[model samples]
Target: MSISITMIIFSVLFLVFIIRLIKTATFTLEYSLMWLAIGTIMLVFSIFPQIPEYFANLFGFETMSNFLLVMAVLFSLLQLIIFTKYTTKQTDDIKSLIQEVSILKEKVKKEE
Candidate 1:
């Protein structure tokens, strides 16, 4: 109904897509599983009448629709932030690992 609501619904769908992508992508098992769980949980919670009702009315067709959209947007943003952080950490780790390997190679060459 409203812009925020539309955004939220779109966002939720986006999160689900991200989860699937993660599963297929080269990310580690733990990371992929974690994202999948997070996406599913968010989707389930949003659909569950009792949960959404606690904070605000979720039964009205237009209202619920709008609310859902907003929720989706918030969830998507949160996931993105988390994903970015994980990527940054992973990148740094790879760099560190590369350095370690280079040092090991040099050490092996010297001892030979």
Candidate 2:
């Protein structure tokens, strides 16, 4: 019923979901590791509710929620950048593969 208890439950469920994804090969280890780390951090914070409050005060935030929100936003931005880099690399690799296949097809045609 309390926020901390809810967070703890959510964190556990998230960890389980991530593990299942990894087991089923739906998510690669590299991607799952970030999620796993996030879940672990969430669990830790939920277990010790004062940790975030202490950090918020240390960082001069007006409230712990604001501090958490800022952190979540930063994490989301970092994830976006990483995924963008991966997408660009995959596109380039696909283009290279297509070019290679086209060249091979032309060679086969000439041989035939």
Candidate 3:
């Protein structure tokens, strides 16, 4: 019924979900690893239950919720950065493939 117990339960469930996704190839190892790490960190925090509060005090946050909100935002920004990198790489790969196919088509035309 306590917050720490609830957190531990949720973390365990999330970890299981991530593992299932990895096993089913729904998520790449890279993505799964991030989720796994997050889950593990949540589990650790649930066990300690006050580390975040300590850090929040150290950082002069008005409240624990404010600290958590800032942490969530930072985590989201990092995830966005990672997805952007992946999208850029995919775009470049598609461009390269298109160019290669076009060159092959040109060679075929010349041969014919």
Candidate 4:
């Protein structure tokens, strides 16, 4: 149950990141790459954690290696949240600027 919920959350975020990448192809290609890498890495390890243990020990928790796994999931979640907020704010600012331009154009036409 919990695993399904987690998968759903990750899937939604992965979709959003892909959509954003397509929307802003050039400027964000690099940024999108990093997010994709993080998401892919997390998902892979979440499914098969021994892969990370083989590479390097991210943590030395007493019993549950799940400690490191949880931390990685959390870090990925934080990155996604930050990216989403940033993209939302960027869109809002662009809309505001376009509105301001239209208002200025209207004022210039009235002056003429």
Candidate 5:
């Protein structure tokens, strides 16, 4: 039970889960793309275990695991920021819609 083998198994399972989510409409394709890409990259690195090590050394990481951990953290943070921005925009849009409806209701009330 090597780390590489474990990674490969988990990556495949992750990809399958993402695909199933997309198929069932539980997760939108747009959001699932990032997860799919991550899973694919994990699978690739697992199959060719040397790639991460090479990149880790090239990037001055103390170890491949450290490099992977840093990259995953950075990627997750970026995704969180993007989703936050999206949520803010949606909130603003919803507020604007509510205001418009409120104004329309007021006008209807006056007419009545």
Candidate 6:
């Protein structure tokens, strides 16, 4: 199969947008790297359409598109798990800070 011009153009546009976002501080490097890597990979694949098919065959996927979808879903789930952990830690820290502040306020009131 041959790569389409539209796909290549879209991938390049996406890569450019991602870099602009990073430069503008809209997304930190760590947060933006995943999308940057994805855009880069898509740009590469758009140039070499056969690479994905080879990977699909090596992985026993019936189609390269299916392999791509599965990988996207897996990555999304992994990100969700990481975000959940980060949120939980933040919540706990907030609770601890609030409790400490209340205790300090109580001590100040007693002294006054």
lDDT of 5 by residue, 1-112 (tens): 9887898999999999999988898977778887888889989999998999999999999998999999989998998999999999999999999999999999999999
TM-score of each prediction: 0.54, 0.95, 0.92, 0.43, 0.94, 0.85
Model 3's alpha-carbon lDDT is: 0.91
Q: How accurate is candidate 5 locally (lDDT)?
A: 0.92
Measured over all alpha carbons after superposition, the RMSD of each candidate to the real structure, in angstroms, is 6.8, 1.0, 1.1, 7.0, 1.0, 2.2
On the 0 to 100 scale, the lDDT of residue 8 in model 3 is 94
Greater lDDT among 4 and 5 belongs to 5
Q: Can you give the lDDT of residue 104 in candidate 3?
A: 100
Best by lDDT: 2
- Evaluated at residue 111, the lDDT of candidate 6 is 100
Q: Judged by lDDT against the true structure, how good is candidate 1? A: 0.73
| Reference-based lDDT, residue 24, model 3 | 93
lDDT of 5 at 59: 98
Global lDDT of each candidate = 0.73, 0.94, 0.91, 0.73, 0.92, 0.92
Q: Cα miss at 104, model 6 (Å)? A: 2.2
The sequence of per-residue lDDT tens digits that candidate 3 reaches over residues 55-75 is: 899999988889988999999
- Model 1, 1-112: lDDT tens digits are 8654565576599687876777687667776777667666666664564565554563453465577678779878988998899899999999999999999999999999
Model 3 RMSD in Å is: 1.1
What TM-score does model 2 achieve against the real structure? 0.95
Residue ranges of candidate 2 with Cα displaced over 4 Å: none
Number of clashing residue pairs in every model? Answer: 3, 0, 0, 0, 0, 0
Error of 1 at 5 (Å): 22
lDDT over C-alpha atoms for residue 87 of model 3: 100
The TM-score between candidate 4 and the true structure equals 0.43
Off by over 4 Å in 3: none
The positional error of residue 83 in candidate 4, measured at the CA in angstroms, is 1.8
Candidate 5 segments whose C-alpha is farther than 4 A from its true place:
none
